[model samples]
Target: MSTISGAHIFAKKALLPDGWAENVAITVSDDGHISSMQRDTVPAGNSVGILLPAPANLHSHAFQRAMAGMSERRGQEAHDSFWTWREIMFRFLDVLTPEDIGSIAAFVQMEMLEAGYASIGEFHYLHHQPGGTPYANLAELSDRIIEAAEKTGIGLTLLPVLYQHGGCDRRPLAPGQVRFGNDPDRFAMLFELAAGTMSRLPEDAVLGVAPHSLRAVDEDGLTAAIALAGDRPLHMHLAEQVAEVEEVIAARGTRPVEWLLRNAPVSENWCLIHCTQMLPEETAALAKTGAVAGLCPITESSLGDGIFDGVRYTENDGKFGIGSDSNIRISLSEELRTLEYSQRLRDKCRASIATPEKSTGRVLFEKVALGGAQAIGRKAGALATGGFADLVALDEKAIDLEGREGDEILDAYIFAGDDRMITDVWSAGRHVVREGKHVKGDAIRAAYRKTVAALRMRL
Candidate 1:
């Protein structure tokens, strides 16, 4: 269904920036921003039980959703680490055509919408075909990603990634990594073409830049990427694994986080993904920089990556947001749950992220909502005038959330419930999910199933 211009949404209770409010009414302009908001108002237009500012999934590799459950078997290595799992990922992508990418991305975006994420910052790097052959159009894969966002009606932040080398030693791209390689000049052209394709999306769609990782992009390439990004969001993978830390230290005379902070102008515009292996000093320093820590808790656990020092970082006033990095799972509640649980498991403390004034769920939901918008460069993250209309509603009638008010509502919905309580989702005024289902859920699922079936046969 096409979104109605100047649509109105009323909520029985809403988690506003200041605090929870009751009987809230909001208006969305044709441009997809909240034109006005009023509290203590009568129910009008599309009414809901509970409302929240839905966060953007700040870091994602959308094509990886197809390979979710296929890599669980044990490998020859004594310990199946991120490196070993990556080999399987490389093999999986060799068979994915542009059509497969489009189908898989559409399904992933649809799932994100249903999971309560209103937008995505897709860190897209798969550029060439098998054997490292450039397609007729350089931005073919990016176009597929944009088309997927359009079909799902989810807000898009397409971060065209620049991946140059295979390791810190500046080695040639490996056979599996070749499809993601592009020299700085060629990557600039690819980024430009990708930006051109983004006009197919809504006005809220953003184009950002990512220097794939410290291992993949050299100092010069990273500088070029920062230049390309200008003032837009610039994301990078950093210090996700122990091996990666050792390699960066051996090559650059410093750890990943330390090296980047000393070398680059790290600021709020940059989002560093998976800083799961940081020293306390590095964590404190990074927090002071105002850069976003793009955490992917589920993927980190799946790959056996170490836990981030979230307590130390937050104490230093760090900004953080959650993402479905590997796309193995996309539940927003589980991401927050896994993050808080990891901290508790490490420190043997309860309510690791909760403050004296706020419960665990309230703190996590509010922090992620604001930080995610900052990381993706979206004007959202609050039920206030001038923010994008990215909203999620929960079922008050659900047993988990029944009779809950204020912070108690968030506490129960997150700790005692899951995305099942997400009854409706609006992405930039586009009401994509209603009654816990995507408007095009069936079609997206059918396409994904066919693609995965053919993919399995090929494997």
Candidate 2:
């Protein structure tokens, strides 16, 4: 037997960078990347159903996962905007310990693996304790997130976020915001500490930096963050709310995207999350900068955030990726489906994401996979020699997927099925999911239930 868990995978049909191929055989090396591949080859292992490259969830606050469904009820305010929802999030974080976060995050990653996401870019922001003191180990919470990823076998791009001020005016950190606050001097140390935690991660794991958002970081702090991040992947939230856009415009003399394009050395290394409120000019210009727009369609709808200008962005050939932000519902198919459906609703047209030749589902899958891989700075989103072995297998036996082939398989799954159609997943050469369930799903779910139950009582 091979010393490591190196192995082979065979698919009757698999989607490659160019297009779908038949009788594909993939060789997984001990280092967790494809060593070689052959088309129209004999089965190397059990011949599976249609195989597809999975996308990285490029923006996530893993700790917010625990509070997914608790905020749906109406609050005392007549209009519960993103601000009110943020208040609820603050209250929830005040009592959370690092151990609880680890368990919650493990569950979330397992769900993502089972749902056909090969990797995650965790935009982790909660750093200190409830009382605003750093742990003896500055990377204590970062270590917990890494532990969760290790347990769940999910590829992680760990982005340690630097959150300084409370708003555009550089106000003091609010009581609920202290845990997420840090100075430039301290943030540099935190970033290094977080990077150190990745030594134990699987191959293809990445370390990145996030400046939170303009509301949380002044220009000086943002510059400091960019300097520390260097050429690594840098992600930050953009205008997800009208109030936030207005605040940025009033404070910076321009909109959020406009300011960043003019001010920051924005490039492919940057990922701007939630461009939900941008002018058409802003959209097209930002697209030309090569920064990937990190979109969370489900969470955007759930939080009442406005729709993204995806039509304009795509028309301009903009790069974009999807995320399960807030983890309200982690479904790979749902994220892409919601994205296309939103455009259809807005434009009143079918196949809004499709080229005249390519099907909508095929285009959506390829675009997200490529864009997400770029945002995370990893070798994924394709099946070829030297590519990370990240793939999802759809159950051809599924009643909904019966008799489907090629693009129709993807179209049916994205529109008709959920995770139920995903029979297996391999991330970094490990078969983490089999038979539509994560290998560690039961144990992770048990721990997650226990943690959430105790947390509910406190709430």
Candidate 3:
């Protein structure tokens, strides 16, 4: 039903089966899947520049986008860590109505579309009303999120989260966690209800499950949750902070990753978020498991979570994907830049993550795209038939990309250019962004501004 002819197309360039072509034409069916791709030269249409499959953001907390800059101030303690930042998050989350959540999610998804992210794996846990009370309709909040995704035209992977306890020992959830708390049975019900809602979304939408973190679920709860995931993607927060690692050790006699590897049926279906504190053995073991390391480099760096062991993990053939987790900054290029830059700074070497066969940015981009597609259980992350027609076009005339060609374009886009080069984006055959601006960016942002203004009054 739709066609896009471009100067060049990076078709299937994600390591699964990779290549590029010039003067390409891609057609999309009304069902939103790729209909056909032709490599021969074609008459140029209104569209220009290179086209490639856009990346899936493998992890995100959509509501946190509103709290992005608000949590940057120092607390009474001079030091800040994940725990301190969490307290700020708790405070910010206290005032969000389901409507507010929807507005904020739409705003963030719009930003994602503009910045070349076609889909987002939203690790949603903000269920229940404020004050820890259940809403009249348990799935009201989730419906709002699905509504946001529909309005923005970005593909959705709604990862309904299971968060039960406050720590590894199964202590009761704190008052602050009331909104996020649900026992296994209640969580299952919520999951089913959310799934029904997701069924109404565009074909590109999916439903996945997430256990909030190692500290938030007991062994039994985790096992049941994993079983609930079945063939769908299974995501979890793991070993993100030193204190979390210490707590898991004290409570379980092992590090979080070690315990998870031994206990859970982790395979390609799993996406372990922020394995930041793993030992070399743990890192290698995780890599061997075929699971994705759902790395949120910008958010991890912003929250002061330590850098992941990228070199050792990659060497062990690890799969990895990037995300905007907190969405404090939503640009995909910034996420990749921060990921490589973090490695560069840690090892005190330039281009420390590049493979012998590929340039640094090319390798990172390709791997993340594949891993992200796998993690979200989508047939995407490449420009090919049967894949979702999610593509991003970079402006050839952008200053940072003017002299770039081939993989250098990717390098400069990630390393030097941010969102400026992202001239257009299409999600499932829908042109959601044009000329570096989302179609709904201004209206959605204005709605978000109003929502945040009201939230400020409540805070």
Which of the two candidates, 1 or 2, achieves a greater TM-score against the reference? 1
Question: Model 3: per-residue lDDT, tens digit, 16-59?
Answer: 24555666766677777777776655543435576777889999
**Model 1 per-residue lDDT at 202:** 82
Question: All candidates' lDDT scores?
Answer: 0.94, 0.90, 0.85
Writing each residue's lDDT as its tens digit, candidate 1 over 300-360 gives 9999999989889999999999999999999999999999999999999999989999998
lDDT preference between candidates 2 and 3, better one:
2
**Can you list the residue pairs that collide in candidate 3?**
none
Model 3, which residues run further than 4 Å from truth? 1-17, 44-46
lDDT of 2: 0.90
- Candidates sorted by TM-score, best first: 1, 2, 3
RMSD (Cα, Å) of model 2:
1.5
Residue ranges of candidate 1 with Cα displaced over 4 Å: none
Q: Sort the predicted structures by lDDT, highest score first.
A: 1, 2, 3
Q: Per-residue CA lDDT of candidate 2, range 49-168, in tens?
A: 888888899988898989988898878999888889989999999999998999989999998999999999999999999989999999899999999988998999999999999899
Report how far residue 181 has shifted in candidate 3, in Å: 0.3
